[model samples]
Target: MPRRQHITVFAILALFAFIGTSFVLMFRSQPQGADYPGPTSQEPVLVDNEILLGTATAPKLENETLKAELGNAAWKVLHTTMAKFPDKPTEEDSQALKSYIHLFARLYPCGECARHFQQILAKFPPQVATRSTAAAWACHVHNEVNKSLKKDLFDCSKIGDFYDCGCADDGPVKGKEKEKEKDGFKQLELEKEG
Candidate 1:
């Protein structure tokens, strides 16, 4: 009887060990965050000094032709907002941008529109890029949106894809616009981290 008891105890211990090992292996194999290609090294990418200017300028999206030409569904949201705001810029416009950003940051949140805005901001002058209170507000929005969207969601993978930068088509070119794109990408990455 004693030998039988010892064997039973050993079997239980082995079972527990097998379960724990399996759990550890599964956790380690999972991918972290969005699949966007991040900087390989620990060193931070240098921000464009020229793009660090005061306030980001409001992008021109008013012309009917430009509005009609926008290809992305997300750009349409921005265009609709521009159409509603027209000539007079308000605190609401800034708030709207912020709200969109926050929503885009969420795992399953709609990111198409917010990504488009980031691309547009990448074209602004440094002073305008850094100083725009509106842009700062939008960043806050992006953060908030992410938080709100993750509350009830189970699958984080879907959300990551929705917000991932690799999904965006905007690429950096070899000129001033490229500099702006870099800054914009950095800003989005920072926002995601926060």
Candidate 2:
């Protein structure tokens, strides 16, 4: 076999080894036996009539670098999601967004950070009535986290400018469509008169 072929084979083997190890570590890390279910008997915590996962403790993520990277990525995902939410959401849509925030806090990788977020959720309780309110709520909660971490607070009013999400602007579409429909009707009336 050529040297390049040998190198390719070695790389393939290394990749497979890495993937296998990752699977093993992931499964091994799961909580064993009875503790896996987490909080069976106690009543679930609730805020705004939404059920919350109880404050079960998790081992703190001690690696500061990894924690910071995770925090940045998570915040981007969260802010963008809120930014794209429907302008006038249904009750179910509102509830789903509220539930997702609670779940995200409950399952956040940094255990100590997750607990802090849970406390924030309990106090703030996700304002999901509309896109503007939901996005504002997310900004406010992010500011709360920033405050707790002694970081510079973000100006909530300028949140949309910061998290653009690069999606097309949907804010004015409904009003524009209504105007077009009214003009279309007027054109039809003129045609019938002729």
Candidate 3:
């Protein structure tokens, strides 16, 4: 065979070898955590209403990356919410945003991540006084999570540059949540219509 053909074949073999090894390591017999299910079930155990898998949902966990992907998506939602917060929120608005974050931490599907988030929230409570302050607070909290994970910290100064909720004039993100935000305010879209 030509040199190029030989190299291609070797690469294919190496890829297969790597995949096989991964499966073996992943499925190998090892003691499960105290919370892990008994041998009869592959499903994860629930602790205090939190699903303790690497990830979870109404749908099944697809892979190891699902947790990180969900985290990314959740962060996008949060950052955008902060961006669209009212410039001078009323007392109700402030309470609503504060309640939302606490509920988010309590109800997040990932047990481990949710617990950590709850702790973080306790340490650094939500700051929802105004749009800039809210957004800045979100950025700071994200950086805190990053620091704990040993991930590179995000640049808080450029958070607005990073997230685009697609709201016009820095408006609220469109969603079911907007129809009835925590304080039961009128829908943002309807307000725009008036």
Pick the TM-score winner. 2
**Residue-pair clashes per candidate, as listed?**
21, 0, 0
Q: Give the least accurate 10-residue stretch of model 1, judged by summed lDDT.
A: 124-133
Against the reference, the lDDT scores of all candidates come to: 0.41, 0.76, 0.69
Candidate with the larger TM-score of 2 and 3: 2
Residue 63 alpha-carbon offset, candidate 2, angstroms: 0.2
* Cα-based lDDT at residue 115, candidate 2: 91
Tens-place lDDT per residue, model 1, 1-194, is 69999999999999999999999999787778737776778867653433332233344445555443542444335323322331234555444444443333221122343344344434421111221223333334434433544633323222222333331334535678656645553443222211
**Could you tell me how far off, in angstroms, the CA of residue 140 lies in candidate 2 after the best superposition?**
0.7
Worst 10 residues of 3 by lDDT: 185-194
Summing lDDT over every window of 10 consecutive residues in candidate 2, give the lowest-scoring window.
Answer: 185-194
As a whole number from 0 to 100, the lDDT of residue 174 in candidate 3 is: 63
Roughly what TM-score does model 3 have, to 2 decimal places? 0.54
* Model 1 TM: 0.24
Task: List TM-scores for all candidates, in order.
Answer: 0.24, 0.60, 0.54
